[model samples]
Target: MERGKGSPGKAPRVRAILAGGLVLGVGAAITLAAWNDSDFAQGTFTAGSFNLQGSTNGTTFTENPVGSPATLGFTTNPANLSPGDVVTAPFAVRLDGASTYDATVTLSTEASTGSLAGLTYELTQSEDFGCAETVTETLVTAGQTLGSTPASVTFDLAQGAGTDPGAPVNLCFRVTAGAVVQAQTGSTTWEFAAQSQ
Candidate 1:
């Protein structure tokens, strides 16, 4: 409105409105420091809470006693097994025959992945036969029938030399974690095998 002596549009309109309000307050402080550095990078990584309950420090585990048994390098004497020795597995195990000869046992229980879904625990496997045998081994079938939920299972027992003098075919697995273990994702380990046929 003045136009001239002091200036029309006072000093170019206050230097273009103070350089557009100093570039809008530095673009709102660079958008609030890029949104607080993206919320500290979305709270950052995770995964450090475990309770995969499953253990056996050793009372007796013929094939897998945590360290010895040649660390699964069987040469024989897998508690003293003899009869062509053709036992292989990762499915709970069992076998007994050491009084003499006439034994047959088979165990099976495998299949699981990622984190062993819906895993509950209570496992058992035992054996110690090394003196008598005479046609006594029943439990040739009960292959595989799995189910998982909150998780619960009951296994059967076999290996009977009909009232002889050979008693050491044993396998005792246990896992009473309950509540689906609460938390455990990796190796709740479960390797097994039984022989003598």
Candidate 2:
């Protein structure tokens, strides 16, 4: 019987591979354990009731101890505000408290007689206080329906690590559309909400 040549170091090679794989697995587990944190998802402030349209916009929206500060505001009437007979309002959103959590605020409009192509939004925040962040819309839809208005907008915030514990932070916004020749019009409600990851 002829003896076949065998790789004498085959067993050692196999052992080395297995050892490397085990080390890598343990290292991965350790890395995961070190970085896994649930606190990052925890919210420091309880969420307050969201008012899509409050006393802000054309007027001032003061903050009450029980209510969250107004981030957006505006007014709308169903009969006169919309291109047709639809109702919509102005809007804003709050970037509030510790900017740790993220949020998206929106404003939408009622059905219109035409398209809202030239409309845009501008957001304003107090330069002295809370950096009152304001954002304006870039466009507003005209052909859309009233009850389905998308005067909506979203925001993502990263509050610096050292913001105040609980201070009144306000983010205001305004809207203007159309040209000097065209009748710039849109109707919808303003909304502000905070969502965290």
Q: Pick the candidate with the highest lDDT.
A: 2
Residue 49, model 2: lDDT of 29
Ten contiguous residues with the weakest lDDT in model 1? 49-58
In candidate 2, how many Å is residue 29 off?
Answer: 37
Residue-level lDDT of model 1, residues 1-197, one tens digit each, is: 34566675478889999999999999999988875433333456654221111112222333444343223222233333332332222122333332233233333344334443332332234333221222133232222212221222323334436433333333332222222233444323332333333
Question: Estimated TM-score per prediction?
Answer: 0.23, 0.30
Q: Give the TM-score of candidate 2.
A: 0.30
Residue 195, model 2: Cα distance from true site in angstroms: 1.9
Model 2: CA > 4 A from native: 1-55, 58-90, 106-136, 150-153, 158-161, 164-191
Error of 1 at 171 (Å): 12
Summarize candidate 2's per-residue lDDT along 10-109 as a digit string, tens digits.
7788999999999999999998888654544555876642222224453443332223443332444322332223223343234434455544444443
